[model samples]
Target: MKLSAETLADLHPEISRPAYDRSKVTAGILHVGLGNFHRAHQAIYIDDLLARGGSEEWGILGAGVMPADAQMRDGLKAQDCLYTVLEQDASGDKGRVIGSMTDFAPVSPNHEGILRAMASPSIRIVSLTVTEGGYFVSAETGGFNPDHPAIQADIANPGKPGTIFGAIVEGLRARREAGMVPFTVMSCDNVPHNGEVTRAAVLGIARGQDASLADWIDDKVAFPNGMVDRITPATTEARINHLREAFGLEDARPVFCEPFRQWVLEDKFTDGRPALEEVGVQFVPDVTPYEHMKIRILNGGHAMIAYPGALLGLTYAHDAMAHPLVRGFLEKVETTEVIPIVPPVPDTSLTAYFELIEERFANPRVEDTLSRLCLDGSNRQPKFIVPSAADCLKAGRSIDGLALASALWCRYCFGEGEHHEEIPPNDPSWDRLKEASRVARDNPAAWLQMSDIYGDVGQSPLFREGFTKALNALWENGTEATLQAYLND
Candidate 1:
């Protein structure tokens, strides 16, 4: 049967459903992006909290500013904002219906509904999981890009704002005018120092509209930095069908993820928040250590494998992990280069953390895609991989494996996979990256000159020489042989 509020009672007794009464739950959080990751991760936590017989006021009102979000709204509405989360592991699969999300606003051009939802006094927290690139950070300065076209448009027309930040600013303005307290603007994206980046974007947009309002927001509002980790792959038709076959349930927007999930949040909210610590969330004074550890080892490990995996035409992440060369390259690079620069995280050993990451990547049932990991290199490489490389360079550490990873990125951008299949447009700067890759085939320095990506690290003689050798090896010897050289060295 189709899963909905009405069908909750009829589902298989084995399938987990909400223990708390969904009817009594009220909206206290307005989450901006209703993507699979947020659904499988944050919503699940809230669901767990409510099931424990409390936090009834902390239900989620899902909102989206982007045009693509309209489809999500439709899907969620069809299911009565109740969807399935299929957690897969070596043991088996378990299914649960998440009831934390009460409703989703219709995606609109002006985003009037979303603004009103955010401005509501009852909504104390405005959380977001928009991807890393959605923050409008400058590649050159690594700060808010005030000159971005969307920001410019929002500045000119403040009342009818077009971007997410614009909507947020307008919402905050309405609350201020209504004499209501501002909501905490928490960013749940994968970027390092996500709360700070969120604060910069919101303040930058607010400053363009009214300096006084920006000051008020800066003084009153809270943006808590957080680190969220979950391997929730994009849902496929087969996955949806699997829900039907496995549990006799039909869910339009089911989420399939690995069994593991984590959220480390800085404990700073303006009004109040759900007692998330009651669940598995770690409330910390500082999320930096945890953030650095996960971003460097787990996220960086993904970067280490993604390009070469895609070039070699591996489909699933576990398939790449199973390959001897790919596994060896990841082990060598992370241990020798990336982990050495990572600062110590409390209650965690970097070596054990890497082992956990390897185990997660090798989860066969999760089926995380190599192409998904390989997407948006322009944004991800900076956040995930390049900072480690830059730190290694600054510390005068060997960057041989790191350089090879960068070279693989450049080669992957050549609009062809290892089997010469046509690589779709994966990056925002595809043309430039492709041209640079073509040029660097002859002179390796050509790719590094794209300072927006490589920055001064490319100019380092050690990095340059290592990158040159890696690029040449990739071209002359192929990915497997190149990986062997890095491994054997």
Candidate 2:
């Protein structure tokens, strides 16, 4: 049967269905990015909370500002915002229906429906998972990009704002004029100090429009920093078929992920929040320690493998993990370089955390594509790998492995894998990245001179030496030979 509230009663008895009343659940959170990660992570938490029988008013209203969101809107609405989450591990697989998302706004040109939903007094939290690059942050200053064309357009037409930041500013302005409480803006993206970044973007856009409005948002709206972890691969026809064959059901927007998930959030919500702590989420006074550990270790590990994996023609993440040379390179770099810079997090040891990360990456059932990891390297490498290199350089530690990882990225960007397969353009900065990669094949320092990405780290003598050497080795001997050298050296 098609998965919907109307058909829920007729589902197979063996399937794990929602125990709570979906009709009683009301929208309290307006989530901006209705991606699979949000559904698998945050929305699942809210679903579980409602299943426990109290937080009915905290259900989510899935929303999106981009035109691409029209696909998601139609899919979720067709299913009554009811989708299946299939969790897989070594042993078996389990499927559960997630109904925390009560509704999705119609995908319209002006986004009036989304703005109205955001202006609602019932929405206590405005959360987002709009990827790393969605915040309109300047790569040079690590601040809001007021000069971005989208931001510029929004500035030209404030009332009919186009970007997410502009929409947020307009919504907050409406709420302020109506004397309604400003909702807390929570960021669940992988960026460092995500809450702070969201605040900068929102307030930066608001300031350009109205200084007093920006000040009001700064003083009133709370942007809680959070660390969210889950491996949600992009849904595909094979996965959909697996669900249909396994459960005898049809769901257009089903999410497939590993069984493991973690969310560490700073307790700074302005209005109020669900008792997500009662579920699996960790609520803390500060999320920095947790954030650093996950971003640097977990996300850094992904960057470590992605380029080399793609260059080596490995298809899946587990394939890269199973490769001895790639695995060894990742271990050496993470343990020696990355983990040393990360402060000791509360209740967690860096070593044990790495062990968990390793196991999760090697989960055979995940089948996460290296292509997915390799996408948007222009944004991810700086956030995930560059910071560690900078920290190591300041501490006078060797950044050889980190440099090699960066070199691998340059090699991957050459638009050809080791198998001579044309690596399609995946990054927004593809033209410049391709040119730099082609030049860096002979002059490695040329790549580092892209100041928007490497910053002053490129000028460091040690970093330059290491990056140049790694790039030379990668060019001369290729990925496998260079990986072997790094492993043995």
- Predicted candidate 2 versus true structure: per-residue lDDT over 1-489, tens digit per residue: 899888888876666888898889999999999998999999999988999998899999999877889998998898888999999889888888888988998777667887999888999998998999888876667777788888888877888988777888999999999999999999989898999999988987889889999999999999999999999999989999988898898999889999999999999989989999999899999999998899999999998988898999899999999999999999999999999999999989899999999999999888899999999999998888998999998898889999999999999999987778899998999999999999998889999998878888878889999999999999899999999999899
For model 2, name the residue pairs that clash. none
The per-model lDDT (C-alpha) reads 0.91, 0.90
User: In candidate 1, residue 42 scores what lDDT?
Assistant: 93
Clash totals, every prediction: 0, 0
Tens-place lDDT per residue, model 1, 347-455, is 8989998999999999999999988998899898888888889999889888898899999999999888666798888888889889888899999999888777777
TM-score (all chains, Cα) for each model: 0.98, 0.98
Give the deviation of candidate 1 from the true structure as CA RMSD: 1.1
What lDDT would candidate 2 get against the real structure?
A: 0.90
Clashing residue pairs, candidate 1?
Answer: none
Q: Kindly report which residue stretches of model 2 are placed more than 4 angstroms away from their true locations once superposed.
A: none
Weakest ten-residue segment in model 2 by summed lDDT: 136-145
